[model samples]
Target: MRTLPSTGPRYEPPRPGSNGASPFLPPLPSSRTPIDPPDPIEPVEPIEVEPPPEPERRKLRVVDVQDRASLGGAALAGLSLTWVLYSRILPTEGTLGFIVCWWLSFTAFYLLLTGLRRGRVVLADRFAVLLAHSGAALVGIALATVIGYTLIRGAPALMHWNFFSQDLRTAGPLEPLSTGGALHALAGTLIQITMAIAVTLPLGVLCAVYLTEVGGRASRLVRSVVEAMTALPSIVAGLFAYVVLLISFGMRLSGFVAAMAISVMMLPIIARSSEVVLRLVPSGLREASLALGATQWRTVWSVVLPTARPGLATALVLGTARGIGETSPVLLTAGYTTYLNLNPFSGPMTSLPLFTFKMSQSPENNYISRAFGAAALLLVLVLLLFAFSRWLAGRGRSGAR
Candidate 1:
């Protein structure tokens, strides 16, 4: 207690007229005393920022003036050098040889000029483009040459109207172009091909459906067999038909037998090609169809087949093209005949290819002209069939959309 110095500030009671308050609490702050205001906020100056620079635009050109100039210079130089070489250095005498030499020289000159003008990467790109273009040009030139040659050789026979209406029955190997026609061969071709298609179409489509929509171990085996048959020689197919139908089954040789042989060749083509087309049908369509409570077969029938109709037509065309041009198969299965026979199962028949082959063997200008004419006719017939198929496929597409 030794005068416990005042441990706390002395507590004072409220004075009169003062509001009553607790004495133990600290005194309230006096309102009259000056209080410093918060320092005035400074208005911030906004910073000016520069936008990032725009990326440079690159110009793409297929062939600029510089490229055209280089091509012209290279071509001119190559031609001149090749001419000099062929005349003064090389012993080449043919037009074909000259063209080949020119092409090689042109390519060499092109590479040299491009290398001098550009870097390695650009040089490689240009060279690749050149090769692609050159390949296309060569193909075009070859095709044009073949067509022109065929036309020139066939023009004399094709000029006769009766060449399409009459038959070789009465026309001899030395007969004039106006005497004989390809009617019998044309009719036989149509009948045989029609029969082959009738036998192969449903079988091929079903096989494709089985392979694509209901794949299994059996499908794999079937696929392997189809692939093998795709490579089966035409002669082998004819021999198979010959042995199985003509020898073993006692079936007579006729257009019907030829149809069977053609069917053997066409079936694998249609099946394999159609299977590829069916596979291209989107899986999303199948899934959506299944989601809507359709069964697998129903989905494939309703969605997949319709969707791939155009490609199926193309496959059919391919098969037809393959079978129609076959010479050995028709020669072996359908014996050559000059008279028109409507019944495929009755008499010997001949197709366009067979007719052409037979006519070509005769040592006469008329026969040779007839052969060339038949070939041209075959080409035209194929073109017509292709166009018709394309039209039908286009119709399917428009209807689908």
Candidate 2:
């Protein structure tokens, strides 16, 4: 008899546990497996069984848990050595020196222990990271101490409301904080900064745009001048204003002159910082805009500037901070006055820095307190500016989105 034509592999049932069985279950009975003989042409197929997974890896730690007790012992030894060196072993008298010495010793000891446990390579990496963290912590501690000390010293004068609303002109150095305030100085600072910002913002931003987007032979010269001005002495800026406005033209010392000097000082900072911000704007955005047939100016105005607006605002605030805290420039150009002068062209106007200097120069303790209070107010004003900038930047970013 003739056999039917072959189709494909013949259907055969899987052996027991050939499909991966649960590890928790007992082994299947051998009787369940098929024991039928196979045809000659259909070969036996081999089953693939995957091996068990390897265990998880653990990272090398800078400090091992097992060595925690040793770490504490090392720290104690370092601290004791530092105290001894600061107190009797060395000529130093400061707790700061002691802290520095202690930290150094602790770091060195920790590294030595790490090297002993791990290896030289791991020790080096750990040492570098530890050093960086220590430096940052030291900086934070220094700032906290300085700000705390200032707040403590100025608390007396700052408690009075009159100090925020009055000027040093009306109050004598011997007068109490209730009578004479830093109001006039506050007004002057506000006026000068306003003028400087008004003048500097447009000019600085344009110069930055020129440098980044339209770089050329002329731009290089401009960049060089701007860079040179970054190191321009505050005294030189003051003298330049004095010679140009007072000596040459016989103009009086006024807020206008002071603002001009401050503007000169602020311009370079704003320009350079804005340039950096603008440069950081991704080139892909610019290229995409141009590909859509938008002009260079249009791309910058619509895409680039808006994207970089927050950063540019930060640049402006930094420049304002630099100009606002200056003493020498305001001293030479604004002159010292106690009265509130709204006009930028006439009357000598004083800033917080100048007011603080004058107050501290006196022999009275009250004046010194007021001086510290003025400093505290200045810090608050700067903080306010920074906050305002941040708010504005947030708003702009939201609007863009």
Candidate 3:
């Protein structure tokens, strides 16, 4: 029998025949080796990859020097053109017209210069961004101007010590700045605002809790009413207080009535704002508290309300601010007075807004100055409260649920 060639899987060289060169038909070349399969590839170890570099932080100066130069040129041209138009072309120097002129000139120049340097797409983007930033800056500038002007006009009255220590009862409208202060008005405002807060906070907070935590179909109607009340005019609130307390009932127009009117204005604001804040608390927090066997009210009181404390404070402050600056409600309910009245129930009392309004209407320069001073004080107080509220919000931001 003929033996079969070795059937092993590994590659092997062809066997030589009985005689040399007799195995295959072709003869091998002298310098060539017989064909063989390539050697098996060795297994490779895994590669170690280097970590990527961190990205560089961007600089705050988004605008380049070229852009700044363009802006400067636009400003110079705008101011010059505004001056010429205001001085020579206009019939009056109430240069509000000049403001429009300057803005138009600046916009025209800015677009022209930017379009030339950059392509149209880039120019459009830059113009839009700059316009928005410029608008915001303009608002800031206007606010600063108002505050500064009020301070400058009221400097004489504010500098006097009697403005704080005494009341308008003894000081005539024509009297010198040193003789009288808005002490009574200031005191009345504080007391009335305090009373309003006393009435509004518990009710507002509870209403918010109901809307956010225990909401039902009735909550929708309540929410709609609150939203509508937010836009309710100050005069309407005043009229409601007047009709309810003075005309319908037998109550006098006193500081308590004023407080009630302010309470009306403040209540919806606080409740709506508090609802927003409470909704911002995470669902996970309530779930976690309840998961731990805490009751619903306990979860709200311990987990939700505490987490939202700062925001609630901010809402309260915002409501107080809205009521504090109001004039119409105080006018109808408080019946402006100059004398210091410690009791909210007994007699007519003045507030800062009322005092300022009465003083501004007078023909005397001293009265106008006093009005401006009171306005400045009000502005300063509002700004301080706003800043404080912002601080509270920021402090609790990291811990918010």
Rank the models by TM-score, top first. Answer: 3, 1, 2
User: Highest TM-score among the candidates is held by which one?
Assistant: 3
lDDT per residue (tens digit) for residues 238-322 in model 2: 9999999889999999999999999988888899899998998999999999999999999989988988988899889878988
Residues 93-206, candidate 1, lDDT per residue (tens digit)? 888888888989998998898888788998999999999998999899999989888878888988999888998989998788889898898898899999999999899999
* lDDT by residue for model 3 (1-401), tens: 33333333666576655337776667555565668876754444445566677689888765799899998898888788778877677765766777877888888888888888889887888789878998999999998899899889878888998998889877886789989898898899899999999999999999999999999999999999999999989999999999999999879979999999999988999999999999999999999999999999999999999988999999998888888899999999998888988899989999999999999999999999999988888877788889988998888886653
Ten contiguous residues minimizing lDDT sum, candidate 2: 40-49
TM-score of each: 0.77, 0.75, 0.78
| Stretches of candidate 2 exceeding 4 Å from the true structure | 1-54, 79-133, 282-300, 387-401
Q: RMSD of each candidate?
A: 19.1, 13.9, 17.8
Minimum summed lDDT over a 10-residue window in model 1 is located at 1-10
lDDT of 1: 0.88
- Candidate with more favorable, higher lDDT: 2 or 3: 3
lDDT of 2 at 175: 81
Model 3 error, position 110 (Å)? 3.8
The list of candidate 3 runs beyond 4 A from truth reads 1-67, 77-103
